[model samples]
Target: MRRLPWALSLLLFSAAPAFAAEGLDGKTLGLAWAIPFLGMLLSIAVMPLVAGRFWHHNRGKVAAFWALLALIPIALGHGIGTASQAVVHTAFLEYIPFILLLLALFTVAGGIVIRGNLKGAPGLNTILLAIGAGLASIIGTTGAAMIMIRPVMRANDDRKRNVHVIVFFIFLVANAGGALTPLGDPPLFLGFLRGVDFFWPTVHLFWPAALIIGALLAGFYALDSHIYAKDGHKWLDPTPPREISISGGINFLLIPAIIGVILLSATVEWGEVTIHGTHVAVASLCRDAAFVAIVALSLFFTPATSRSENSFSWEPISEVAELFAGIFITIIPVLAMLQAGTEGAFAPLVALVQGPGGAPDNLAYFWITGGLSSFLDNAPTYLVFFELAGGDPQRLMTEGATTLAAISAGAVFMGANTYIGNAPNFMVYAIARDGGVKMPGFFGYMLWSSVILLPLFAVVSIVFFAG
Candidate 1:
């Protein structure tokens, strides 16, 4: 969800002016237009720390306030029709599908709980993390995290020092693991939607993803072993050792069904319908509808006991929805400026990625994309750089292979740099916290990533992007 606010905001603002007789050009728009978007980001970052109670209760209202600040000006400048159309375009074509997929995965995975009493030894913990990383590419980071997290938590329930376990889970399962496939992460899915081949990432990102995951797994093992030895392995096991079995098996079947619907949407172009002067793709509409149906099915068929066992609740998804609505609304102008390329207000950003000989710099692509994705939403950050590199999928896949790979690797891997770097990272954090893991505060988590993940990313950059 880290990228959702920034990505969604940029998209809605960019599209808002499209219906006007004379649309606002990014070249003509000034930096001041991006204030509301920045405000929304600041509110998200600072409010929770300064006014935790107020932020928790009124985050939706705060999101709405920032959104209105952006929209009111757009309506005035481009007329109400243009603003309305922009809202419709963003809602139908982007945000709805995005949220629905997350909802479906969360719901289905929540229903399937692993029943076990395994201890969380260093070797076992490493194996679980490895399994999760492998599953992430197949079922998505969100799905894999939802399915695996509770089991991991249950295994480590007796450990006095378990915060590092959850932190590394966020690093590996929730973010970096999703790099190898479109289904693995939202940014890659967006690339798929925009005409990048589905297997392109698989072909290009395998080694980079493997290297990072391997490094993290090794690092986590060393850290966990030290903590385990320091604690004298004297912690009482909460659940007596027993054979592991799975409950709510039906939901396992639903995971692939969700993936199928997404694939159907991408492969089958069923034409589109124009609503309020915005073209809505019928395939996307169908995909979203199917996701809703899947949600219903998961809730109906899976016994309430299973969900209860997983400690499933609606608060996380609800919070993401409310806050991201505002983000999507506020980011419209900033995305427009970036989309304007060299002619726009963000011309300096456009110029920064070019090399001395005027070609696109792969290292700059990796760092800039990763840096923004670390704080903002990686999906739109990937898009910004994708367009900066000329936005030709065919050319990017062929002649600019390294550049595309750099962008993809950066967007996916560096999202682990912070909890807000991706949607699953925060959800994993919230779940870990609720499950009694004293997860670090936002900055605390950043410190963990800074010490551990940053150096690994530097090595990756040198190996993959520096050439």
Candidate 2:
């Protein structure tokens, strides 16, 4: 389409340089630099429970307030060069591309209208989540989640106790199911971009991921069945079942375009464009350009009724974009500290992952990477651990295969531990809440992940990741 060419040309107008400066020296930054980041997370976690009305109405304002807390100090303490470089680098090299990918996936997937609601029987519910889990590897977790979540919700819309179902969906479809492929999750995709073979996760993580996914599905089915039986199974259907149909099928075409854009960026190299000391590949810029085209095309071509009928709203994506913007900016110091490794503040964190005789402890790698990823953004967490473990793909793939597998599984699987743990987790939470599912609040959701997934991951570590 003509739109595609125009969008490609949009890449010519790159982000204006913000003047390269010496980067934030994490070694010089005290633990106090992490205050904004921690406060931001606490605000997200506590503000909702304490001031539900205020948080709902002014989430963006809260996000901005914390973002400034992160920025102003850097400008005052470190100077404009460091501040500008940090924000610009994050905006260009990381956050924009991150948001664009989510936006394209969210737009394209949201347009798909699953026309009829089926009875949300335990058996049918299990099958739907299972199908969604299957699609996660192929379409990416966010896409799979966006496409499947509504229909699953619709089918269970009549149920009195449906919250658990959505929780398990978050666990399986949004997290564990994404463990098997680079395309399945952001962390693994980061791994792929860093020179891990494309099929590496698929091969190494298959059994461990399968075991976790299968266990979650089974647990969800059992829980749903028990709840359904308690509800007396004879409740009047809110909207009686109708013949299933899928609308906006044409929008599905954008999926491959999304995949192709990512693959193009990864598989090809173009000259670099440095913006504020961050060198972004021209190909990555073009990829972002292509995503803009795909989103526009999706919006223009898809029938408006398709989204309206599906109860799709832009609010979820808007909230995610706003909140994650603050997160990425504030997290600059935290990531830098981790990146500083042994020389920086969290040096003792380095020792935990090292076993007797200085060999890397696979299980410790799994737990620590997972624990940090449970709170920090998992993609960069994966990258940090990847560097700590020698940063050699060839060596990691062959001799340190188990260690690589542990990091991969931890980053992908433990992201379900909290709403903010994975991008898709929060998006799914917002959408479900909008759909009137009474989704759990931040810590409440953590309780669910702790009770269900933590034990399961323990089994996985013992079986597969033991050093």
Alpha-carbon error at 390 in model 2, in Å?
6.1
lDDT of 1 at 329: 70
- Please estimate how well model 2 matches the true structure, expressed as its whole-model Cα lDDT: 0.81
lDDT at 262, model 2: 79
Highest-lDDT candidate: 1
* Clash count of each predicted structure: 9, 0
Write the residue-wise lDDT of candidate 1 on 148-243 in tens digits.
Answer: 998899899999889999999999999888988888998887677667888899999999998999999999999998999998457787767778
Worst 10 residues of 1 by lDDT: 10-19
lDDT of 2 at 300: 95
lDDT score, candidate 1, position 133? 92
**Could you tell me the lDDT of residue 360 within candidate 1?**
83
